[model samples]
Target: MKHVLLALDESDDRAVAQAETVRDLFDTEHTTAHLLHDFTDNFEGASVGQIAAVRHAANILEDAGIAVEYHETSGSPSTSIIEAADELDVDAITIAGRERSKAGKVLFGSVSQEVILGTDRPVLVCSRRTEE
Candidate 1:
């Protein structure tokens, strides 16, 4: 079975939309979806490495009959995702990308961009286009 790591930020609505897209694209019967969240800081009531944004995405995959797993870790978001993918030996890493201005990207390096640059594994970026 193909193993896919879905890199998600639980607080982002775009991640929810990306989850739906991932569910539709992969074959549930033949694929395993791993939901991953990189927590950079401690939040109240959260154990270290516990994901706050998994249920909605997990529900979508589970309802489709796809095997699902969750992985949460604390670190640089891109680095954490790369480490998880390497450790899991996932076939691909999927992430939701949002448009950022050149200035924004220069100031704040993008996690998706870092993951793509740091790893040789195929990265699938699901982008949400914003209406102007």
Candidate 2:
């Protein structure tokens, strides 16, 4: 079975778009998606499944016949994502990319960019656009 690590933030649109990318690009019946959410701070013992965006993405993936697993952690998002991918040995990683200026990226540090550079596995970056 194909394994994909879907790293999600708190944005429903972005999470749904990432889920759609996996549904459209892989064989849903034979693929497994591990949904990972990193709470950067103030998690207060919350779980990944409790997040709205994560729940939305999970529903979409499940509806498409994809097997789903939930993972939650507290730390650096990009570091957590890369470590999860390595630990899960996922075939690919799917992440949402937001528009950021060079200065913004340089200052804020793009999680997607760091993840893309950190891992050797294939990465599918979904655009922020949700509309057709």
Candidate 3:
């Protein structure tokens, strides 16, 4: 895989870390990971906190000899992730899942769910937020 987009959120270290693990498993060079924090304004402003998460992931992956680059974009986390993955022509996507309350799921539609349903590329989901 040339590019792998890893979906992340502000309090979601679990998911970002899992995404990096998938990148390692693939042994893909030229790996680029995109994290979409949030969208601001009416398509004009954006708040992408995933940049830090991406950098954190890159450090882990790079130490293992995997090349990594990360991008922070703005928009609905799910929408931004899919768009970025498509833009990058990602071969696959890795995502970490955290527990979401009923309200959280309702408001966000669950990022992991959205990425799995929306993308043509393979998505590796790690269910760890509640995993033992």
Q: Which structure among the candidates has the greatest lDDT? A: 2
**Whole-model lDDT values for every prediction:** 0.78, 0.90, 0.63
Regions of model 3 farther than 4 Å from truth: 28-52, 100-109, 127-132
Candidate 3 lDDT over residue span 95-127, tens digit each = 766667877755434777898888888987754
| Candidate 1: clashing pairs of residues | none
Count of backbone clashes, every candidate in sequence: 0, 0, 1
The TM-score leader among the candidates is 2
lDDT of 1 by residue, 32-76 (tens): 988887778766657423554577777778888888887878889
**Model 3 — TM-score against the truth?**
0.68
Worst 10 residues of 3 by lDDT: 40-49
RMSD vs true structure, all candidates: 3.2, 2.6, 4.5
Candidate 2: give its CA RMSD in angstroms.
Answer: 2.6
Candidate 1 regions with alpha-carbon error over 4 angstroms: 45-52, 101-109, 129-132
| 10 residues in a row with least lDDT, candidate 2 | 100-109
How do the residues 88-111 of candidate 2 rate in per-residue lDDT, one tens digit apiece?
999999988775787765533378
TM accuracy, model 2: 0.89
